[model samples]
Target: MSRGHRLALAILLLTAATAPVGTAPVTANAGDGALVTAVPNPTADGDAGEYAVVRVPTASTANWTLDDGERVVAVPTDRPAARVALTATPNATRRLTDVPVVAVPALALSNAGERLRLRRNGAAAAALTYRDAPEGDRLVRTDDGTAWRPLGYQPRDVHRYGPATVTGFVLPDSPSLPVETLRSARRRLLLAGYTLTSSRVVDALIAAHRRGVAVRVLVDAEPVGGRTARGAAALDRLAAAGVDVRALGGPRARFDYHHPKYAVVDDRALVLTENWKPAGVGGRSSRGWGVVVDSAPVAADLAALFRADAGWRDALPWRRFRRGKTFAPGASAEGSYPSRFEPTETTAAGVRVLTAPGNAESALVGVIDGADDRVDVIQPTVGRRDGPLLRATIRAAERGVRVRILVSGAWYVAEENAALVEWLNGLAERRDLPLTARVAEPAGRYEKIHAKGVVADGVVVVGSLNWNENAVSENREVALAVRSDALAAYFRETFVADWQGRGRVGRTTWVVVAGALAALVLAVVVARKTIRFA
Candidate 1:
């Protein structure tokens, strides 16, 4: 069957209106249990496809249930999943009226208006519901049919706390779903409808704020010496437009926000990228691709990290640096972090935040040395590098780190980098490095890999730009060093697909010779034209 048909089959399986296990009582996450995510309620039945599947954190080995009405289907057992499809019948109100959320010591999710409050016996619990819907479906346990919370009763300033969760998305150029697919991707996200933005994206938060969508953005505040005057102008525009724009510190500070291209919409969809320009660069453009998830725990944790980092609060419109207060972007809910690197400890998971005085390059080297199980790397510009990052990667591959790299760019910037790229390949071929491919082979400039990410042993380092020191040391950088398995696993799968693409760019052909001849003829014609003009 076609891929589209297969995808349809999967959804059909999720919504097949069948009851689950006929056994007696089965338990899930204990206590004032569970936090999750979901889409805004559909305005009517026309909003059917617009629903979001939600999966709360439970046993990795435990099966899940999505009880819309009499239809009970089993959601796959995983750390973060969105397999639960909520079928909203008309007048079937899905609110945060009932759902148990742990205290600040655990995780919580908030709506656009306020924190998600779980009401037990009409009393508000301290832990906010991690996933609460204003429109569509909210939390209702299949075990007891209890609605645990009331909607919009939680405070607006209930700071989000817990260890950082990350969603690592490397925009791959699927031949069928090319870069232009970004427009469709943006449309898909917009169609899902979020309370976080007015338009899906592209207008920045000014438009979102006006739409009553909570608008928050983090931009790199660092100077790129003389390289690209990109971030400054964009942030300026956003700030002037009445958006909540903040600048993370430049290369000089201790906790600067270096990578600034990623923004998570409504904590359900994320755009992780290096091409932060509202447009592309130097005659060449960019291709963007990513996944929209149903897991709110994953979304909430990531959004929390973006807020806690001090780099975002120092500059631009939300210039809180002068106020001397902590850089708390939103009120802390439950699972929140102090920065991208710090862990607030939510779901029994641990996190590590690798600082980048050296920027992404430093982070890359750290990963090479840190991996115990799997190592996956993604790059838009894995350009020429003589430094520690390159050496560390090679060493890790040699030592059995299961090193797999997806270089999105062609390493075509400098002749030197292309040569180095050749050397790295030669080494991998010679068994000097145990590397595999994840992205489609460099498909010229038309399609390139633009994600700079590394995930190892349930840890993820994702951010703006690529796998080159040019970005970390000289350019402005910002990223999250994630410590959640949910985020890390997502990075791993996306990395695998990208690596497969890289593997497909097989042996070079004589097309190079033909291309060279063509270039020579064109150059001659141009030269002759210039002479005639003179």
Candidate 2:
């Protein structure tokens, strides 16, 4: 708000107002599908209530005027120039591939509950009315109808994306997974996670909103039932606080459930292998790993996914949950699981992002297959006895690599994981493989290892991708594979600490204990029979 900066912004605004208007390729008017595609309420350079994006459809004329209820806002004339004072991005391809975009520089369309109209030849063609628009959101109309999607995040597809500087960090340590991390958001906050039940986290977000940060959140609709009811209740609390919240998965949802967990604050992308619930990372109730990426491209990539899911208005629909006390229906997927999002390639210098219901399994197997020396893993759930991930670990052990797996020993996670460990140990004994498995004990600061991460050779794969069939092929998940020793070693040290802690019990010791209990029971039964005979 300095004088010099204000003067520069004013100059830019004047340029946009007098800039030559460019002609469109067609003669279609507002009555056609010539609707607005993007309205960047506040451009990166300009303040709010100063700019907007107007989409002039293909085969349409650019000679049109926009109105803000009572008066005219913009009138176009013949001058060969781009429509917008700033460059705008397309929400999609196909019909909107090459649509001419006009960046209106002087429209005061930032206030909520204001009606903005596009008119041609004195006839109103299209209109947009917003209510509590989230911070940094763009109003878009991709189809012919008037339903505009509030796209809060920007899109940067894979091909157009660039390198990312991936930095590794351990959560509940060093920086610790505290609410203060979110409370520090300055400009925009984009959050997409599996579940959010932590009150401190929610309160921090509310505080951020009060401080004028544009905050938006997307969470899985399931878990509204069962033991995870608090997560749904927290969503209600967030909505009541005026935070723009959206639930993924309802009647017309895409996948079985949405399960990706990450957050973008300004240019930083914080990816995690835990949910936003209390037990996941709050106070280190469970062991988890997180990565902080200081790359704009990486942040933009995640922001794009958020935008797609939040703004999905197509036939394969994504429904928004209403703010209420009653639980929303269609939150659960029952037993039917399906694929929704498409997979794309992500390769940077030392990091790669793999999304599930795609090639995440392949990427995971590829990491294990490429291991040359050792493999260390901490997972809450393992796949089937002979699944791809398990088989890869077995193969790694077969090749004389030191393979160690630390699985959850908490009651709920122990049943499924214990059976897998017993089977794997039996197989390892028979095949003389170097694989060793242990179940984490629930006696320390952390009760369970809810993370899905591995240190194979020098590469680290960490995120919300659980080692299960459903996680890889049914639920929507995300993970980061960093092929750097420094990053991998950070996780490796944490793994080593957990391995040596009293919280982990080896497989061989469990077998011996089970045998001793059986012997004790038989001896007691024999003594009772002798006493009865006497």
Candidate 3:
């Protein structure tokens, strides 16, 4: 009851109020399971929109603080979670990702990069050090959370399938092949392409839809030449028939172009190096290559890819997309060629599905790098000379492998292709390598070359992947690597025929050439007579 006893009791109560909460107070150590998972730099308006993501092992981050060498901001305690995205502008950060964002008024990430430390109780818990941050990209922890890498989007995937029987066909010679494949679909059909204007294909798709088959189509909203009236009409017809139609492209599109040409029909997957237009699938023009694989796994993988692309935020419904759109008048392929190559059913030992913005570039390069006997490539146009695919082909030739590249001779690319051929030949002569490059001469067999195909040893690559950097690095491209000697032989035969300009000109072409020659001769005779008389 004394004054000294009262003072001692008050001091004891004060010490108890400020003491640690438990027998073992939480300690801040570098080995603690906290980590700085992701950091976005140079977003929108410089560093104003930049953000950092930190992950803690326990649910609450109440005691954590983030330090950027110059500024230290307390982690918001309003929302307790294992992962929290701290940013100066919470609204702006939320637009970039769905991760929970916490506004830390003092949070500012340096664009030039620096060390970021996560501290608790004034001690270091974890730290992340980075160099110059790339613009429009985020430095995020890998899947294993061991390292950091710059990425603009989620990591792409490479799908692989086991052995299956594949039916191979070339364009202009077998236009009916792809249509027939579509018609054969009974359960479901997921088609993806850059353009779709082939009347025969549309008819088949409509028929499939009418038969109660689930038919879905996904195309690019803004293709290179823009969406055409014919394409829009076809899409309109499909949409009217209760078919699900979508277009992939917008301000937030994940890919530069939805340029994959493929279809999952029931349990089969059809992959092509052509569009769904007449020139590509109708075989009216273009020397393209396609295949129908009767495999459940392949079809499932393609269907999954279709769903991923078509389900993205950028994929708008056809009706919704065409609301304020004006379509351009587009030309259709009308030329006909002799059916020199027929669709042949063959079995492949394995099929590896490669996608772009992820694995196509590296996988194709690996295929070429593994070639031992011969490597043949046919493309409309190639990327830069130093691109990965071209460099791989050159490397193949350097290692005593016979390499042949046939590029398109279409007027639009004839000059550039010729220059490339000349340069390739010059390099071959200088290095004494077994490499040869040539510009394809259609020779009346078909129109310009449009196939993006490659035959390497016993493997054949067929799909929408162009041997260009953008097509392989930025686009949502798909390609299949079929390992089969028989399939290789079929594609090899077509490649050789096109390369040698040995395609059999149709009877109509012969008649035109003959008529032109006869008229020229008659004109010559008349000119001679007139000159003598004068």
- Overall lDDT per candidate, in order of appearance: 0.40, 0.61, 0.79
- Relative to the true structure, candidate 3 has a C-alpha RMSD (angstroms) of 14.0
**Comparing 1 and 3 by TM-score, which wins?**
3
lDDT, residue 237, model 3:
91
- Sort order, lDDT high to low: 3, 2, 1
Per-prediction TM-score to the true structure, in the order listed: 0.42, 0.60, 0.79
Output the better candidate (2/3) by TM-score: 3
1-534: candidate 3 lDDT, tens digit per residue: 221222223210001112332222122442353544455553466555578877655545447777867888887545656577888888877766667888888887765556677776666666665554554455533333322222335555677788899999998898888888899999999999988888788889899999999999999988987888999999999888888999988765667788999999999999999999888888888999998999999999889888878876679999999997888898887898899998899889999998876788889999999999999999998879999899999999989999999999898987788778878877887788999888888888989899989999999999888887678756889899999999999999999999889422223234556899789879989888543321
Which candidate comes out best when scored by TM-score? 3
What's the best-to-worst order under TM-score? 3, 2, 1
Better of 1 and 2 by lDDT: 2
Worst 10 residues of 3 by lDDT: 9-18
Candidate 2 lDDT:
0.61
Q: What lDDT tens digits, residue by residue, belong to model 1 across residues 1-534?
A: 221222222211111112232222222334222224343433334443222334334544444343322233343344333223333331232322222211111121223322332222323222222222333323333222323211221112112224433323333222121122223322112111001111214353445555666566654443333213233344445556766655545322223234544445554434344343322211133433333332355455445555554322133343442233322232211111111111111231433322232334555566568877677766654654556766677777877877765554444543443444555665677775676433346333234545566777776665554555445543334454555676676556655644544343222312444688688779989888543321
Query: Candidate 1 — which residues are off by over 4 angstroms?
Result: 1-204, 211-241, 244-258, 264-271, 276-348, 351-355, 358-364, 383-386, 409-417, 429-432, 436-446, 474-476, 483-490, 502-534
Model 2, 202-306: lDDT tens per residue?
Answer: 887888888898899887765535324556667767787888888775433444567888888877777888778665546345667777766777777777777
